[model samples]
Target: MSVKISLFISVIIIIVFSAGTFFLVSQQTSRLEDELLYRAKIQSVLGAETVATIIEEAIDNGVFSVNEAFDTDYQIFGNFDPPKYHTSYDSYLDRAILSIQDKFLKDDNLIYAVAADRNGYVPTHNTRYQQSITGDPEKDRVRNRTKGIFNDPVGIKAAENKEEGFQQIYHRDTGEVAWDVASPITVKGKHWGGFRVGVELSSISAAQTQLVKAMGLIMILILVVSLLFTFLYVTKAMAPLRKMTVVARNIAKGNELESEIPVTRKDEIGELQDALNRLRLSILIALKRKKGK
Candidate 1:
């Protein structure tokens, strides 16, 4: 057909492909977010339970006290030395706990840890917790939340079930959320308090965002390649049409119309070229008749 019509079809194909790509990308983003959030929540719970079991074992053997190991003056895990008077068991247990904390830090999702008495007193924590909760307020909040066995869900659950763990979502800061995991510290069937761990949503959210951006870049690259190919295809298809235009222009300028359009495909453009050839023959016949007259 005409060049204008061919270009219109190409534009329509491009639009349809673009819309399909956008919809697929949007669905992929949603699925990724949902799966990441669910996995983050489950991972937080597993981490808290695992660490609590280690602490409970140590406590059972009388190796360490919740208060002594995590006191302000005592730093167990990173670069800090264990107390000189600590028993061999204490040192082993402290090292184990520090190793767990180090692993949590390495994971991008982890946020905080809370070890409190039946009362919600902040005990041991990770770096994110230290940054989020302020000095005395952090302690007071924990204490207050644990005062009435009813105040803290994790506290009460741990106290009641004497189980290893519980998980929940906590709004730690305005417009920010964390997945909290807590496990009971029971020594010889007696629950002393519990251990809590918090995994921030931001880490997972940021990862998802980065993934979407990378996918977007890939889509843009594909579109660019498709556009390049389409331009090439259109240019090739229009070559015969351009030849026809030159022949018509020559005929208009009183030059001989000897060249035939070379388009062989039986499409609308081919049909139009054939009609032009017929019209040229009719014009030549009229010129011969007038010359004889």
Candidate 2:
């Protein structure tokens, strides 16, 4: 019975400890993901703002002024014609995208990069855009559509006059993903275009998997240690009871009551030992009286 009780207590303790460890590990992983996402959003917004400022400065300095260049007099910044201007503009855009992508790459978890203008034109991609561009309905829609951020599939309410922000978007191929941030580079309060920074959802999941693996290892270690300690504790606790069991069996077999039981505790076990010794003395005294008669 005592062995059963000890086993029960040990099991409960193991379970409780394991549960707490799992919870703590899970919380830590979630917190890390949130922190990384927050940092990504801030970094994306900063990159967009920097790009926007550069463009605005270019406008001021006649690098590529708004009206004379695009010829699309729509009061909105549109395609810059002439190979030179596009080349220069694309060069600047590429540098910014590359910088952000390098930063993401430096972090081991992040895998891909995508930045689109408000027009959703693919500005920068680590992968060959044509390779992934399957001739599918979704791709067709993306190619045809002109505006709206599509990465964070869920609509994160675009900030009022947002120069930069962040959201999550989903790809039909991959569902429920996270984006670090997406920001619009605005000039003169008109929506020129935007840049988006994306961090793969796989990054978060990968981290979570690593954490779970680590926790499992720790739990195994704990269980092994606990098992050893429980065995030692139970053996020590039941030692006196084992001895008492042997003493009772010998008396039932009508053996001489000369053997002594050791009393090492003041608890119930000790009291039982004292009672057995007194009973042994009484039986010996009765035997002597019987011999005299």
Candidate 3:
């Protein structure tokens, strides 16, 4: 019975500890993900503001006319089949935007930093994508200049709303999970376009997985240690009761009492041992009286 009770208690302890450990790990993971998303949003908005400032400065310096530049209509080819831009006119703003995007891409998590006109025309993209295509379908799809139209839901939302927003989206070019953030680009009080920054989620997910595994291993180790100590302590503590059981059984079977049970400490187990000794003494007295008669 004592063994059963000990085992039950150990099981409960294991359950409780496991639940608490899981909750703690879950909370930590949630916090980490939130922090990562927050940082991505900040970076995206900052990039947008920086690009907007550059365009505004160019306008002030008489480098470009906001009305002509923003309203320029570029032709789209392929009839929405991975639509490509067919334009002979290039703006000096393209070089500046590409340069800023290149700096933003230095961060490993940042997948792309791009800008598009209000009409969803991309004049320039990251240098890697701007490089001449090499006939690889995957490479050409992302690298070709014609592939840069900001017509996706997130981009269109940014352009239409003219405000900053964020969404979890898959990259159209690479199909990777990412946090897509967009901030409006206004030049000289005109809604020129939006700046978008895509931050990949794979790194954050990998870190979370590694953390959970580590925490799980630690929890398992703690459980093993706890169970070991509980088992040993329960066994040792029940030794007195086991011995008393044996003595009581012998006395009832008319067998000789070989030794006295000792009550070493003032605990419940000691009290039990004392009670069993009194019963043993009474039995011996009764047997002696019967024999004399």
Candidate 4:
């Protein structure tokens, strides 16, 4: 009976521990993901505002020809597979906008921050993505992807976004899943393109994984402690009952020697102890009267 009670209490503790651990882990993971997403949104918006200012300065300084940009447009001029584009405006981006893009890349969780024209053409990617071409299509796709048009669903949506902000989760050209936040970039009240900040999901997943492991360890510790406490408590509570069992056996065998069942507790177990003591005294008296007669 004591073992049964201990087992029941241990099961309850395990249920509570499991539920609490799951809730805590889920809540922490959600908070962290929200924080990362918020940072990504801010970086994109701020980056867009800065890049727009730089483009306006270049146009004013005659470094970027606005009319030539509108006329030449995003036309393919190079012979490389996946090709390079021209709008008479890309060179200025390399000189003026690349630094701003690189600055946003320094923020945690962000993989790439770049500006693309309305037609989904990236003028100048960050220095890290501008690796020299190795001519293998597979290698070039991963290494030298600059001057390429990102026409995929997520890319096109970000490039043409005109709202205060736009967000999406999609696969990157480098084949990693990421969260993208984009803000429109305009010059002299005319929409030029959009600026995007890409946050890598692996970074967020790694943090969540570590958090779960820590929580799991804590839950295991708590469970072990609770089980030990249940075992000790049940054993102590059943000690008096075990002793009463031996006293009852001695009375049934008509043994001349029997120990008194004295109990300190005032609960049901103590009541049973008092009743058993009175019965033993009555039987001893009745036997003595019979022998005298």
Top-scoring candidate (TM-score): 4
lDDT of 4: 0.83
Ranking by lDDT: 4, 3, 2, 1
Cα misplacement distance, residue 119 of candidate 3 (Å): 2.2
Residues 1-293, candidate 4, lDDT per residue (tens digit)? Answer: 88999999998998999999999999999998988888888888898899888878877888856765443357787577788887687877788878878888787688889988777788888888888877787787777777878888998899889975588997976689998889998878878778888888999999899999998998898899889988999999898998788787787776643466676679988888888787787777887898999
TM-score of each: 0.63, 0.73, 0.84, 0.87
For model 3 the local lDDT of residue 37 reads 72
Clashing pairs in 1: 120-142, 120-143
Better candidate number, 1 or 4, judged by TM-score: 4
TM-score-based ranking: 4, 3, 2, 1
At residue 143, candidate 2 shows an lDDT of 35
Highest lDDT: give the candidate number.
4
Better candidate number, 2 or 4, judged by TM-score: 4
How much RMSD separates candidate 1 from the native structure?
Answer: 7.8
For model 3, state the Cα shift of residue 65 in Å: 2.5
Alpha-carbon runs more than 4 Å astray in model 1: 1-18, 55-98, 114-122, 127-169, 173-176, 181-196, 252-254, 258-266
lDDT of 3 by residue, 1-293 (tens): 66886799889988998898889899999998787677667777787788878877776787766665575566665543356665443457566667778888887777777777776677777887767756676776666654456777766775555667555475565667787777777777878777777777897788889989989999889988988888888888788778778877887886765467778869887887788778778887887899999
| All models, RMSD in angstroms | 7.8, 5.7, 3.2, 2.5
